[model samples]
Target: MGTIWTPKLNSYSGAKYLRLAQAAADAINQKELLANTKLPPQRRLADALGVTVGTVTRAYAVLEQRGYVYAKVGAGTFVRAEESEFKNKQINFATCQPPLTNQISVLSDAMSQLAKSPQRLTQLMAYHGEPLKEHQLIFSQWLHKRGITQQPEQIVFTHGAQQGIFAVLNGLMQAGDTLLCEGNCYPGIHTAAVQLGINIEPITLSDEGLDLSELEQKIIAHQPKVLYITPNNQNPTCIQYNLSQRQAILALTKKYNLVILEDDVNYCLSSEWHSPIWSIEQGSEQSEDPGHVIYLSSLSKVFCGGLRQGFLLVPNLYALKIKQAIHSQCWMISPLNTELACRVIQNPEFMGQREQVIAQRQQLCIEMGQRLGLKQRWRGLNGWLQLALPLKAHHVVTALAQKNILVRNGDDFNNHQNFIRLSIGDAADDKIFVQQLAIIEACIKSLSQTAYSVV
Candidate 1:
């Protein structure tokens, strides 16, 4: 066939193969070449374009990843038949959820085992809604491995961590009560607080987690009933508290008579140093009391999101109140789901899979930073990018969405500044992720250029 589209290489677009792919896409969409057209084989294409077979192979991969073309097993590649439909399918990089396949496999195996014993399966299906001491014991043992010390009586089950958050907010704080959180708090926390008619003030964050001075001032002024916080791999920013920062916060808690609701949902992905703040407080030399921090954890992120199993490591004094509130709201979490979660935790491969996923995520962060010419390496599922361009966060996010890529604006996480949160776990694999980053890098450069011209 006649030359379909001439490949163009430009410095701003990064790799030569990537630029070639983009050039072909532009030409095809612009009607320079017809959709559903056939393309030359890799060897022929390399010869025609004066490049190596490897270059052509890689270029084809990029095109495939971008949904521009597809290859049959025996035939050459052809333009995708449904171009418009493919473009509309979004690549979501906003929400953070664990990979489903492996978790599903694990859960399936556990379910099969449970099915063998009809007696236990029937018992799990029954609505024994009240807090079950046996279920709590299983969950408590799981948490014990993570450095948290708790007993069956001190544990309360909820639908998930969000419900645990709601339960804590409902049971501890009255209507119109004030609560304190980091400047960029989780959106779920914000929504829960608003619906409950509880006032929440954001404490300014410093290089070291929460600004101690600002937190003290807020505590004095608002006398917040509880300080809800995510200490390790914090949502949106992935900010982990340092030793000194944790110590400082503990000291202030005593002075202000504060109740800390520690959201340790991301604790599984957290490193050894990123211990739960509750654990820190207990081990601290300055801490005299153990009941000040209310601990919360969930299997949603670690095991499977569909299970919706979560636990609250309530202080002995507040256990009854929290349990009462939980009973009124959801009665009991699905004992079936809770049992599945417990089995997954007990599985020998649980820790191995968790570490593997987290490591992959961290590597993705490094690769993204490198592609974007950034020096920072963010941890966990999300990486926060503080944009320097003279554009709104929403505008940047919209531009990405137009490219069929989705990411969260920092403001959605209560950040007042212009920033983007890229969910590192969004991409299914490495090649897809690399293509997504190339698209993002090109988009940002184009927008920055436009902004400069406007100025």
Candidate 2:
């Protein structure tokens, strides 16, 4: 309908198909060809460029595979829509969230029901000094089902998991006290530590779990007040601690009389749903005084992240301190949001749908990784890609960004630069998902061949 599109492929050096594809990619990237613009018919373009129709077809296929354009059967190919300059369109491997399912409809229904109930709305408006008993009971039952048994009294509501992390650190540790954690741990731990003026000491992590010997050595040297861990699907690595590893870590907690801040936020996505480290610590016969582990988890990972609903199970000894810290921070977590989360959790069909969505996404990503020949490990929604020498995470990330794809570098999670953390959270559909991975593969191969370096 617009001007008949013609590409200048002389400056690009590659196979004829690749050169044509590269020209299209460059035009899209440079904004010469805006999103949703239709290309000329294959026969017309082939004649204009003095190339065969088959060449144009292959070139279009390449463009589609790389996510630059998409073809509609009997309708010709058109540029894929670009949502934002920063986010691009379909590929965003940066955030870790539950895959899209019926959550939005569920939330909408819940909101409508709430709007119809004036009394319930009024209740949510008032400030309750403590988390509601009914909500606590619901959460307590939820925890019990997951193998972490606790009284409803011990559970405290938090605005989100990050808040729970901060509350535990601030409630238990002083400004100068040291905290020991995985060398490459959740970035939130570092952020919270900086705010509270707490010192963090890194412990070496092995494939099994934390290097036990290194953990004890750091414990003795630093006399840390707390140990933070993600027992299931450790962030950026997806390494699940085996039973023996859990027992060993629990033993260290008892020996040093150190508190364990157990972060099992990714429990919803874990296929095994293993008993949390907190449960093991509590059930141990050797435990003379059993309140050593502080468990933190959230609905954000399982349901909708915007809900900002999280709950913590604290020991009696530290409950008041953590409660006071929470009060000081935000007064109280929004009761309306909490109510919405409770409704979502109560839905009989929600959990099954959530699981199905997550499984499909996880399988797709695993298969893609296998096909790409990339060394990878996946647990839940996150995948860890290990890059061999002559390939670096930052360079790959930068190259992908140029193509309008976003991903996280390993250094963002830890000091390591050889891995990339891919969160399959924002992908729109299976087609876009495969295309994004193909683009990632192409970027990695191109970088490796050129030995790209960033100075």
**What is candidate 2's CA lDDT for residue 425?**
64
Model 1 lDDT tens row, 121-210: 988888886766777787778778866866677788888899999888888888899989988888899888998999989987765689
Quantify all predictions' global Cα lDDT against the true fold: 0.73, 0.81
lDDT for residue 315 in candidate 1, whole number 0-100: 75
Model 2 spans with C-alpha error above 4 angstroms: 1-90, 267-270, 451-455
Which window of ten consecutive residues has the lowest lDDT sum in model 1? 97-106
User: Which one wins on TM-score?
Assistant: 2
TM-score of 1: 0.77
TM-score of each: 0.77, 0.79
Q: Write the per-residue lDDT of candidate 2 for residues 302-351, one digit (tens) a residue.
A: 88688899889888889999998998999888787788877777766455
> In model 2, which range of ten residues has the least summed lDDT?
82-91
Q: After superposition, how far is residue 244 of candidate 2 from its true place, in Å?
A: 1.0
